[model samples]
Target: MSERVIKPVGRGFLFLDSHPAGCARIVREMSGQVEQRTPERRTALVVGSSSGYGLATTIAGLARYGIDGVGVSFEKAPTARRTATAGWYRTAETAALAAELGRSWTFINADAFADTTKDEVLDLVAEQLGGIDHLIYSVAAPRRVDPRSGETYQSALKAIGGAHTTKSLAFDDGEPVLQEVGIDVATDDEIAQTVKVMGGEDWARWITALQERDLLKPGFNTVALTYIGSELTGPIYRRGSIGAAKADLEQTALTLAKDGVTAWTSVNGAAVTQASSAIPGIGLYVSLLHKVRGLETPVQQSIALWDQLTGEAPLDLDDDGRIRLDRWELTDDVQSAVRAQWESATQDNIAEVADTTWFLSEVRRLYGFDVAGVDYEAETEVDVAWPDH
Candidate 1:
C-alpha cells in the first residue's frame, strides 16, 4: 500500500489534517475581541455559515456572545478516500466548541440560494428558536441558479471599462513567484450574469421569505459583507463586474431599510479566504497590505463588525449608511505605502517589498495547513461527525 499525496486542487489547496491548533488560535482571536455588551437574547440566522467570515461570525455568535441559532451552508462531508472541505471540518469543530459552551446550535448543509433551503431554515428557526433577530449574509459562490427561471449565471472577475493587467503571485514549492495576469474586459452579458450571481438578489429573497413567514423579530437586523479596495486595485475590483454586484447589494440594503429591517452593507478589510484567493491581483495586494498594516484575519474583522452591530453605542455610518471596516486598510498612509510597494514589486523584489511568506502561509492555512503544532505526518480521520443538534 502507498500513501496518498495531498496537493492543490483547482483554486483550493488541501492538506492531510484539520489543524486543531489553528482552529483554536482563530477561536481565541475571535472570542477575545468580542465586547461584553451584546443584544439580549440574541439569535441569528447565518447564511453561508461554514467558512471565511461566515464561519468566524458563527463562532463569535455562539462561543463569544453565547447566542443560540441555526447556520446554513453547502459544504460537503468527507469520505473514506478523501478529506472533507475545510468548511466541513471547521463547522464540525465549531459545533463541538458550541456544545462545550452549552450553547444550542444547528447546522443545515444546503444551497443557500435555493428557496427550499430558505424554507428549511425558517422551519428550523420556527421550531427551535422561535424567531431570529440577526441575519448575516456572507455567501461567496462562483455561480448561482435562478430558482424562478432556472437560468444559471456565473460570476466573472473582469474589469468593467477595459482589460486590466496586474502583477500576481503563484506558489511554486511554497515560494511566491511573481506573474503578470490580465483580466479581459467583461461583456455586457457577462456583467449582467455576474451581477445576477453575486448581487444582493439572494440576500433580498432570504429576508423577504423570513419576513413573509413572520419569522423576523422586532428590530431584526440583516447585514451583507462587501469589499472595496484602494485605488491601486480599483480597475479590477471596485470598478469591476463584482463591483457592480456590490453596488446592487448596497441598494438592496437601502430598500430593505425602508421596510424597517435595519439592513446594512459592511465594507470589510482584505484577508486570505477562499473567495479572495481567486481575485487576480488581490494576493499581492494583501501581502503588501499586510506589510503595511500587519495582517488581520477575517475572524478579527468579523468580531469587530459584530461589535459595531450589537454594541450599545449608536451604529456609526458613513454618508452611504455603510459600516466602513476597511478604514484601517484604506487610510491614506497605508495606501501610499502599498502603492509604493506595488510599483516596485516583481519576482526578484517581491520578497523585499512584500510579506510573501506570511501571505502564502495564510493561504495554506485556509485549507488547514502551515499551522503551528499540527502534525501533518500523522494519519487523520476523514469521517468526522456533524453535531446532531
Candidate 2:
C-alpha cells in the first residue's frame, strides 16, 4: 500500500533505481505490438525472461501464441526507499497480461544457470506443459557461479590479441562526450573466463537435461541469441572477448546438431539493451547506427523472429548455420554510412550526426525512465507482485 514519486536516479548508461509504472507502460506497449496470432497449444522455456530481447520475445510468445510455459530469471524484490529492477516490474506486468489473455505461465525468480533451476524447469515442463516445443536461451549476465565447480566466472569486454583503440563515449554530468577509449588485450585466462560465463556450455547442459527427462517435444528447437557485428564493431564485439564467447555459442549449436538436437545460434540485430551500455565502444557504434538508420528495437526484431520460426517463410540461415537477423543493421551501405558518422562525430556535433537523443532515452527506458504514458511527476505504487503470484 506504499507509494512513492520515482524519477530516474542515474544517467548515461548507469542506473540506480527503476520505476514500476514506467516499466509497466513499456510492457503494455510491447504487448500491443503482437500482430501475429499463433493459436496453437505450445510450451516454451525462456531462460532470461525479465529484460531486453529475452523480455521482448517472451511477451511475443504469450501474446502471439498464447503459450503455456515457464520463464526463469533472477530479479530482486523492492525495498523501503528503493525500487526493484525494471525487469522485476516487467515480469509482474507480463504475468498480469498473460493471465488477462488467458495464457498460463510460471515466472521463476531463480538463477537459470544453476543445475537445480534447470531441474525445476524440467519438472514444471513435464507436469504442467507435458513437453517443451521451443526453448529460448536468452540468458545474459556479467558473472556466473558454476553449478558443478562452485567457481565464479566473470565476462570481460576487452578485445583479443591486442588492445583496441576506438571512438568511445564518456558521460560528463549526464551528457555523453565522445573520446578515444583504449582497452588492453584480454589475457588467456581472461578470454577463457569470459567464454566460461557467456559461452554455450550451459546451453548444452540444458539440452542434455531436457533430453534425459524426455521433456523435449518431437520438434523441440532451441536458439541461443548471439551478435556478430560488422567490421566497425568487430574489434570490440564480433572479434572481441565477447565475440570469443559467441563463437563458442555457435559451435555449441553445431555440436548439438551432431547429437540429433535441433539448435541454432541466432545472430540478432542490436538495439538498446542495458547490457550493451557497459561494453566499450558499443555506445558510440549504436549511436552512429541509429543516426544512419532508425534502429529496429529488440521487440520488433523478436516479433519478426517468431514469424520466421513459425510462419510460412523458411528459417533463414547463413553458411555457418546461424539465423541471420542482422542483415539490415549489417548491410554494407548501412555500415558505410555509420562509419562516416563515426569518423566525423564530435561532442560539438554528436547529436547532429548520431542519435544521442535515442541512445539516452533508450538507456533510461531500460531502467523504467523515458517510458511513454507514465506519470513520473505523480506518486506510483512501488510494491508489485512477482509473475507467479
Candidate 3:
C-alpha cells in the first residue's frame, strides 16, 4: 500500500477518499452541542450545501435537530483517472451517515444560480419533503450568469475606498511565504458586478420562487451567511466590494422580512475555507485569528447558528437586526491582539506571530488530508456513491 499523494490542482486540491472517521467526528461534535430540539419535525433546504458552512449546516440539522434536508450544490464528480472534489466525497459521506441515523436527505448537484436548480428544489420540497421550515443560503462563488437577462457578473475583492496594502501569505513551492499585496480600488462597474454576483439577489429570487410554489411552511425562517471582519482585513473584506454585496444582502433580508418571511443575515467569523483562502490577505489574518481567539471551525460555527435559530429563547440579534455570530472574534481584546500581530507579521517572523502550521493543516483537511485514524497508505475507493434515501 502507498500513501495517497494529494496535491493542489488549479483552484482545488485532489484527494481520493474522505475519512469516514473524520466526518463522523465532526458530526458528533455538532450534535453534542444541541441542548434541545424542536418539538415538531423540521425540514430544511440548503443551497451551496456541498462544502464549508453549507455542509456543516446540513450535517448539524440532521444529526442535532433530526431535520430532513434537501441540498443543492455544484460539484464535480470523480473520473476514472482523477478523484472527485472534496465536497463530492463529503456529501457522499454525509448521505451515508444520515441514512445510518434514519434521517432523510436529498442532494442535487447543479448550479444554484440557475432557475432550473431553483425549480428542481421547489419540486423536491413540494413532492418529497412537503415544505421546508428552514432555508439556508450559503453560496459563495466568483462569478454568476443571470438566468433571465443572460448577463454575467464576477465578484471582486478589491478595496472600495482606495488602494490598500497588506501582508499576504502565498504558497511558494509548497511553502507559505509572506508577501506584500496591494489592491487597487474597484471601479464602479466592478462594485456593481460584485454586488450582483455575491449579494442577496439570488437568495431573494429563491425565496420568491419557493413562495410562488407555496413550498415554505408557515413561520419558516431563511438566513444567508455574511462576514464583517475587523479593521485589519476590512479594506478587502468588510469595507470592500464584498462588503457592498453584504449590505445589499442585508437590505434584501429587510424586504423579505416585510413579505412575512423571517429572513436574517448571519454575520459569521472568518475561517479557513476554499472560498476564504482565495481572498487576498485573509489567510494571514485568519492565521492570526486562530492564534488569538482560537477561531471555531465551520462545524462549530454551524452548531452555534443552529442553536440560536432553534433555542428555547428567542433568536439573538444585534442592534442592526442581524445575528452576530462573530462577536467572539470581534471582542476588544481579541482585536487588539490580532492588530498587534498583524503589524508585526513579516516573512521572518510570521511563524512566531501566527499559527501558520495549524492553518496549513486546516487547509489540507479541507481536501480530505490529515484526518486521524485514516490510513493514507491503504487503498481506498474513489468512486463513492451517494446514499439512497
- The digit string of per-residue lDDT tens for model 3 on 1-389 reads 12244443443222344543344444454455554455458899999988888887887777777888899888877666566677877777778767877878899988999999888878888888999889999999999999999999999989987899988876654566898989989999999999999898999999999888988888789999988998988898889999999999999999999987899998888888889888888988998999887987677678778877775346769988998888889999999999999999878888889888888777777776666666666656666665453
Candidate 2 residue pairs in backbone clash: none
By lDDT, who's the top model here? 2
lDDT of 3 at 183: 92
What does candidate 3 score on TM?
A: 0.92
In order, candidate lDDTs are 0.80, 0.86, 0.81
Query: What does the lDDT read for residue 286 in candidate 1?
Result: 91
Q: Pick by TM-score: which candidate is best?
A: 2
Q: What is the TM-score of each candidate against the true structure?
A: 0.93, 0.97, 0.92
lDDT (Cα) of model 3:
0.81
1 or 2: which has the higher lDDT? 2
Per-residue lDDT tens digits of candidate 1, residues 1-389?
A: 22333443433233453443454455555566665443367889999888888887888777557788999898767656566677776777778777887778899988998988888889999998999888999989999998988999999999988788988877777778888989899999999999898899999999889988999898789999888987877888889999999999999999999977789998888888878888888888998999888866676677777777777435667899998877889889999999999998878888888898998888777777666666666654556666575
| Stretches > 4 Å off in candidate 1 | 1-39
- Runs of candidate 2 with Cα error greater than 4 angstroms are none
What is the Å distance of residue 191 in model 3 from its true position? Answer: 1.1
> Which sequence of candidate numbers ranks them by TM-score, best first?
2, 1, 3
Clash count of each predicted structure: 0, 0, 0
